[model samples]
Target: MSDDEVLLSHDDGRGVRTLTLNRPHRKNALDDALWRALRDALAAAGEDREVRALVITGAGGAFCSGADISGGPRAEHPTYRMRMLSDVALTLHELPVPTVAKVTGVAVGAGWNLALGCDLVVATPSARFSQIFTRRGLSLDLGGSWLLPRLVGLQQAKRLALLAETLDAEQARTLNLVTWVVPESEVDAFTDGVCDRLVGGPPVALAQSKALLNEGVDRTLRDALANEARAQGVNFATRDATEAFAAFAQRRDPHFTGTWAVPPSLTDMNGSARSPGPGHEERLRQAD
Candidate 1:
């Protein structure tokens, strides 16, 4: 496939975007082209304001079979290739919007790390996960060394990485590696429901909450509390928060249009989003 065809992107206009790994013939393994495409796609998604929630999934039946160890382009300097992966990892991890990994089939090596980079993961019951690096006579990279220990604690993380054993979806869930494990047939619908809930949420509030939670483990109790307070203050200033309050008082559902001030490029809005006025709930319901 052409480089442009390596990844597919779609936006629902209701504030949800999906990036699909399109090299399904190889079970969506990351070749140099797909890796570059994935990184660029993620960077673009992070800057897209209408993308309140993003989903990463694979085409065909598989999530990803990990990096293609076989034939593909190689970076003349190892640092350059590794640096590209680091950029993708950091961009995905620090994106202000929530991201969900809708996983199926196998997610191993860097592919598994890619899913772990997302804020949440929804997977099929038959999904498989593994570090797989040790088996390849290699050590871990792609931030797996840092992420795994945090997610499942040090000992378990060491076991997984060192042994390179495969974990079934349920086992991954038990270890807190996978968020939810649904039947393969229902994965799409289930993921869509998750996206809808996220899309309906206040974007600024969600982003701040995600940021706070991401830092909580590394910060002192006092520091975390201070950070949370500052985030809450920011949330209080958003029009979406005001809309939420008004909707509650009026006994109606809230409509959240993700509008927050940042790099003007991150938002298409000329000003902060204005709270919905009277009859807004009906209009929203009708539009839906």
Candidate 2:
């Protein structure tokens, strides 16, 4: 692929962002370049105050078939590849904004786990999911081991992983692996409606609620409750929260920009958080 082939398309609509994986010919499989592209795209999205909701999907048909095992070994070697991939996983899991995965055709191996990592998954009836790692003689990565059990419970997770079963959308839904299932024809419309509900909510409150739930399983009850109060405190300081109450009395949908008291920022790999406004990374790249 050329450096400018647009491996990922970052489309912003109103307060929602839809990132489409663009390597359709290979079913949008993750490769080294695509991995870096996705990571940077998400990092930029997190720092976007205007982005209230994020959606990840694939171009053409397939959501993703998994990593591109066909490619020659990357120059960075195996350990480096794993680290970069892990960073991508961690970034997705901890993104301050709500994210949705819109799965269409095949979602297998790491691809299925990618959907699992999202805050919500909207899949078409034709969507297919599988834990295909064993089939390839490779173990799961992309934080699948951590996420699978939490999502479908240990027993079901084991059954899926050990058996490497391919599950249709409805079957996956029954397993609690899919949040919403719609007809293939209506996937886009249905996903858009879901994004509308997300972007219309008080952004700070929505983000805090997402964090609370995602972290709740690991937190002690005392810490979880304490974190809930602290998250509430963070929400209380936002103008959006104030406006939400006013809109409630006015019986109108509240507009949320997903902004808080301070400016929007992103944390670098070094773990320092700094606000650089919108298109910060792009501007930096351009300057370089």
Candidate 3:
């Protein structure tokens, strides 16, 4: 398949972008080309200021089935090929914008880990998941070793990895692998609503909050608090914080543009805009 055919991207015009793994005949399996395409698409979304939320799903009623091992052998070294998967995994995990995985059918092996890498995962009742590397005579790849243990505790992670247990939607949710399990009919609408809420949120603040949670797990309390303080300072420098305060006072929803607010120097000690001299008003125009 062509690169674009292997991975489809659509923007909803309301700041939500959806990426579909398009190789459904192979259960959306990632061939080497698809891995590259997925990585590039995720990187593009991260760089796009207009994309406030992202949803990763699969076409033809199935989520990914992991790597396309059925393909003919290649000349590349195993480590080099593994690097491609690593790049895709890290790019998805480090995205500043919120991400959701909409799972309809099976998500196994690296496919399951891909879903887990998202900030949130929504699955239909019939969806299935497995850490199937052992069944395939392989070990966990695509951040599964790190994500699974943290998500489900070491004991549960070991059970899943060693046994290659297939989990239904409810079972996965109980283990904290899936965030929500909606009915098959409602999963699309439910995921859309969730993404809509994320899209409407303050982008700068949300990004900071996501970063803090991702990093806080590995930091001391004192370090985490210090990092939070720094994040709050950054948030306050954005127009969204001021808009949020104003909206709260007015009892209305805040509109966030993620623009930089007036700098401290451009604002007086009283927190009002300061015109240092003639024509300074234009200089104080909000920075993008």
Candidate 4:
């Protein structure tokens, strides 16, 4: 990949698109170029009608070390840098398709947040995640504040963010941050297995399910229930759902067809929380 392009290598087969982060030297850090490339890749995958599932992984042993502090043009204004980073995080959160993060090694700072952005994370036993912002006189960037709290609750998220503690893959799994932790040697195979299941499943059903879950997090219980009912009503009208019920009646596998559009309301849903904001990493480190 060119320097301007985030090292994005993709393989599309079996209805799955696997996008690998290429900057192994910097541990796949999200530099400006990398972030742009990632956005482009995600957009492409989302638009591809043939792509049923998407997987994001690092090229080398490490999943991602976080923001590429050593890379990118040195911004004269700190505010600009913060804004750019926040935009990247927002892009990850807003992806239309279900995205999976495959972690094999250390994921720190922005890297940890990137993994958090994905719909699910599949990690190797040796994988480690750290919020090192405090140690570096910074705070969590790249949606760490938003994503972490949702995954682990406010108290645990605060402990990780405030302490800058390193969590092993096993620990992360126990905390419900990662879905699965397997032996390092089996990481690739495990990720492939997950992709296989996702790709073979009903695309419309899966997309709606993801949309509902993401939206539900920010909604009141009644609103969420109503949203769920609305989604279910729409899903029941889809050909995929029809086929699913038919297959169940016949005792056979159901084949899904066509790409479905995620509802605009689901996509536009927003939540209220303390603006853990972008420059927390710097502030925390300074206090230390």
The clash tally of candidate 2 reads: 0
Winner on lDDT (3 vs 4)? 3
Best by TM-score: 3
Residues 233-266 of candidate 2 have per-residue lDDT tens digits of 8986577776677789999977765454432335
> Which structure is stronger by TM-score: 2 or 4?
2
Give per-residue CA lDDT, model 4, range 91-201, as digits (tens).
667666678899988899988888888988999888999998898788878888888889999999999999988999989999999999888888778888888888778
| Clashing pairs in model 3, backbone N/Cα/C closer than 3 A | none
Where does model 3 exceed 4 Å of error?
263-288
**Candidate 2 TM-score, C-alpha based:** 0.85
- Tens digits of lDDT, candidate 1, 1-288: 376544555665667888888888888888778878888888888887878888988888888888888874565877877888898889888899999999999999999999998999999987899999999888987889989999999999999999999999999999999999999889889998998899889988999999998889789999998999999889865668767888999999998875542223322376554656677666554433
Residue-wise lDDT of candidate 3 within 1-288, one digit each (tens)? 375644545565778888999988999998877888898899999999989999999999999999999966787779998998999998998899999999999999999999999999999987999999998899999999999989999999999999999999999999999999999999989998998899899999999999999888789999999999999999987889878888999999989888887656767788888666775557555442
Cand. 4 Cα-lDDT: 0.78
Ranking by lDDT: 3, 1, 2, 4
Q: What Cα-based lDDT does every candidate model obtain? A: 0.85, 0.83, 0.90, 0.78
C-alpha lDDT (0 to 100) for residue 37 of candidate 1? 83
Q: What is the lDDT of residue 173 in candidate 4?
A: 92
Query: Which model is ahead, 2 or 3, in terms of lDDT?
Result: 3
Candidate 1 to truth, TM: 0.87
Can you rank all candidates by TM-score, best first?
3, 1, 2, 4
